[model samples]
Target: MRRLLRLTFRYLFLALLAWVLLSLLLVVPLKWINPPITMVMIDRWINNSSEDFKLRQTWLSWDEIPTHATLAVVASEDQLFPFHRGFDMNAIQQALRERERRGQLRGASTISQQVARNLYLWTSRSWIRKAIEAWFTLLIELTWSKQRILEVYLNIAEWGPGVFGIEEASLHHFGRPAAQLTPMQAALLASTLPSPLRYDPANPANHLRNRANWNLEQQRRLGGAQWLAPLNER
Candidate 1:
């Protein structure tokens, strides 16, 4: 029993060391030479047999995507995405306060954190999972630029049943490519993000339409993609 325990401990330490070294290596310049990996790929491999959920995503370069799409997502999901480092403390606090008042759970995940969780973790929500999410969020923010983060987020964010990414969502919902999505279409897509399978952009119910319109109004107030134009230049 003692020998078996020692062997298990030794293997665990080695595995952890290997993972740390690989993570560090992934941050190096060589990472640029490799093809970008997104959450969709990881999900397909990890959750292939899961019967309860389905998701499909394709990575699109920043140049291939229009600014309107990102702006729409920002308007609907996280208005302060561009300004925040990784987490949004103010929004988190507000969510916590609201949950306390209502006696229910609420989500306060930022775009960056969502990207981190989607790419590396399971879907279940828990205190331990959230801690792991924070750790991965910090690693991604430190290793990747804002543009890369947004690009990855756009590619990984769920749009509908078996549909992921702006490109797929645009084509599936509106019969348009992501690059050509109008503000209304983009806003509609963004609004469905909260519960993609439940909300249909094709013929959104009253609540969905209202939410989409609200997001569109917010996008207009935020200067509508022009705000993100500079990031593309970088």
Candidate 2:
């Protein structure tokens, strides 16, 4: 019994050590290296069976993706992207309160948290998955700058059923490259991000149109592309 217990503990220690080291290896280099594929893309490729399902992604460097495209996502998804460390406590608190009052879950994930989960995790809402996501989120924030985080998020984020990244999304939606995306076109893309599978940016319905317009308004409110200047510093 003593030998069995000792071996169990030793194995557990090794497992924990391996997990930590693996996470560092996964995150640290990503500060400079773009990921070839993300877990989210793999999940979509495996599960999606619709006729429209087509896997596509094109990496555009930060400078290649226009500020309009970048700012639209920041305005629509997480306006606090440049300021938050890894999580947005205020949004989390608000989501908690909303769940308690409405008995429905709402997402309050920051851009950093979304990057961690989309890049490294499976699409499950289990507590275990959340815990792992939090671990990766911490590692990402610690190892990479805010700009790098957003760059990865834009590159890896699923824009539609199988379309990924700003470049592919721009082409898929508007028949233009990311750099040529107009402010309205960028806003339209941003509006689909919350429910990319459900909302079609190419032929937006009434709600999507309203949301895109709202995103455009918010972008102006956020002081346009200049709002992202802080990301350069951190």
Candidate 3:
């Protein structure tokens, strides 16, 4: 019995060590190199399982991506992205309180957390998945800068059915490259992010148009492109 327990403990420790090393290998190089594919894209592909289903994404360097696109996502999704390390405690608390009040769950995932899950993990809502997501989120926050985090998020985010990344989304909706996306066009794209599979940016329904307008207002209030200057600092 004692020998069996010792062997079990040794195997568990080795497993943990391997997991850590593998995660480091996956994350550290991403600081400089772009990911060729992410977990979310794979999941979507497997689930669709149809010839019409396609995964579209284009790799744009940070310079090729425009400020409007970044600002739009920041305004629509996470305003405290530049300030938060990995998680947003305030937003989490608010989400908890709202769940208590409304008896409904809502997400408070920061851009870092989204990047972690989309890049590495499957789309599941188990506590184990959340815990793993938290681990990856911490690793990303520690390994990459704020600018890199947002850049990865923009590149990996699902904008529409089979469309991933700002470049494809821009061209699909507006017939323009991501670099030429105007503020309104960017906001329209960002507005679909919360429900990209459902909302169509090109032919926006009334609610989507309203949400895009609100994002534009929020972007203005957040000091526009200048607000992102801090992300470039380090």
Candidate 4:
């Protein structure tokens, strides 16, 4: 009985040690190295049986993606990205209250949490996925700077079927490069994030146009692109 208990404890310790070391290995290089692919991208590839399915991604250096797209997403998705760590407690609380009132869950994921999920986890909502997402979120918040997190998020976000990153979305949707994305164009792309498959940046509906216009207003309210200056490395 004692020997069995000792072996169980030893195995548990080894497993934990491996997990910690592995997380460091994964999170550290992402500060400088772009991920070649993300788990969700892989998931999409596996599920899509169409011959037309192609992963539309073109990795660009941070400078290659225009500041307009970055701030636009920040305005549309997570207005508090520059200030918060991994989690947004107020947003979470608000979501919980809304859920209680409406009997339906609402997403309160901050950009950092979305980054963690996009890179490491699946899209399915469950207690287990949320727990793992929380774990990755902490490890990332501890290891990566805010700039690195946003860079990864912009690159890996799925804009449409097979469309990933601002660069690809720009070329595919707007016939331009990411660097040349105008404010309105950037806002349009940001608006598609919530339901990329349903919304087309190339041919936006009336609702999408309204959302894009709203995003631009929010971008201005957040002090324009200058709001991101602190995250920029001097």
Candidate 5:
């Protein structure tokens, strides 16, 4: 019986190894190439179960997306993105402290972490899911440049229920292309990213408006798009 149990464990380990290797093969190419679809898109489609339901996403290269959008997200979601590898230890500690004090968990996910989730994982919050996300985050940080990670994150992040990417989001919300978004317009979009369905960028609630203002201030404080200089591939 001990031998039988050992054999079962061996096969299970092999199966897990094979799964990770297969995923690496599939996911590594996305460093240079845009993914045709993400798991979230598929999940949303399945839940809707309607033929008329369409997922909106437009792939734009890193340069095509305006600097305002990048700065806004960095300021709003991950202020230490440029300095951190995949995880921000300081932010995590702060978030933990805040959770203890407030009795509510607030977001501390970095852009790299978000890219890992948006690219390779699902939305649910679980310890198992977080472990997988950390593995993929490490893989991505090693395999892809910071700019590539941000580009993929920007493009794959869900702007609304069916809407994905800034290009689609800009057109859907502001009636303009992403290239033309002003600082305020871009900040508003970034502010909605936390809960896109709950907060509409076109018609921002008071909370969202306040957050947008905060993002704009943070963007200015962080030296705006100039900080993105480090992200550019040499």
Candidate 6:
């Protein structure tokens, strides 16, 4: 029992050390060397490793995607991406209150947090996982520029089964490049993020259409991507 305890302690120490090193790598100069890996690559790797997981298929660069595409996503998913440090405390509080009212579990992870989770963490829901997610999110925000964060988010966010980034999503859905996706197409894509499997962009359900329309209105109200236009150019 004593030997087992020692071994457990040793492993725990190693795990903690590795986690710290990884956090540093993600947040520091190491990221400069890693370049950016797209969602398409990640999805392909996941699919190759396991028969259970499969993505629709898509990949896009920051410039390849239209300004409205980013705006639509931000308006629909996270309106305060430019201001948030990493987590949106207000949204978290609201989500918790709503969950209590509904007697169900819900989430309010912002785009930055979601990017951290999707890029580094596994698809598991637990307090421990969430804590790790928060840590990585902090690191990402500290180390990466806002433009880099959004670029990563756009490339990695799952649009549909096998469809990964805006580029692939635009080509698959509208037979156009992501840079050319219209406001309606961008809004439709943004609407699918909540539940891509359930919401078909080609034939949006009533609820999805309403949600997309709402996002479009929000984008228009926010000055049509003026905030993110500069980022897209970078």
TM-score of each: 0.80, 0.92, 0.93, 0.93, 0.90, 0.81
Sort the predicted structures by lDDT, highest score first: 3, 2, 4, 5, 1, 6
> Model 1: which ten-residue window has the lowest total lDDT?
26-35
Q: Of 5 and 6, which scores higher on lDDT?
A: 5
lDDT of 4 by residue, 148-219 (tens): 888889999988888898899898889989988889999999998867888887788999999999999898
Indicate the TM-score of model 6: 0.81
Taking the tens digit of each residue's C-alpha lDDT, what string does model 2 give over 117-179? 999998877668878988999999998998899888899888876889999988888898888
Determine which window of 10 residues in candidate 6 has minimal summed lDDT.
30-39
Quality of model 6 by C-alpha lDDT: 0.77
- Which stretches in model 4 have alpha-carbon errors above 4 Å? 1-4
The ten-residue window of minimal lDDT in model 3 covers 122-131
How far residue 57's Cα lies from its native spot in candidate 3, in Å, is 1.1
1 or 6, greater by TM-score: 6
Residue 56 accuracy (lDDT) in model 4: 88
Cα lDDT of all candidates, in order? 0.78, 0.89, 0.90, 0.88, 0.86, 0.77
Under the 3 Å rule for N, CA and C atoms, how many clashes does model 3 have?
0
Clashing pairs in 4: none
In model 5, the Cα lDDT at residue 37 comes to 92
Worst 10 residues of 5 by lDDT: 118-127
Span of ten consecutive residues with least summed lDDT in model 4: 225-234
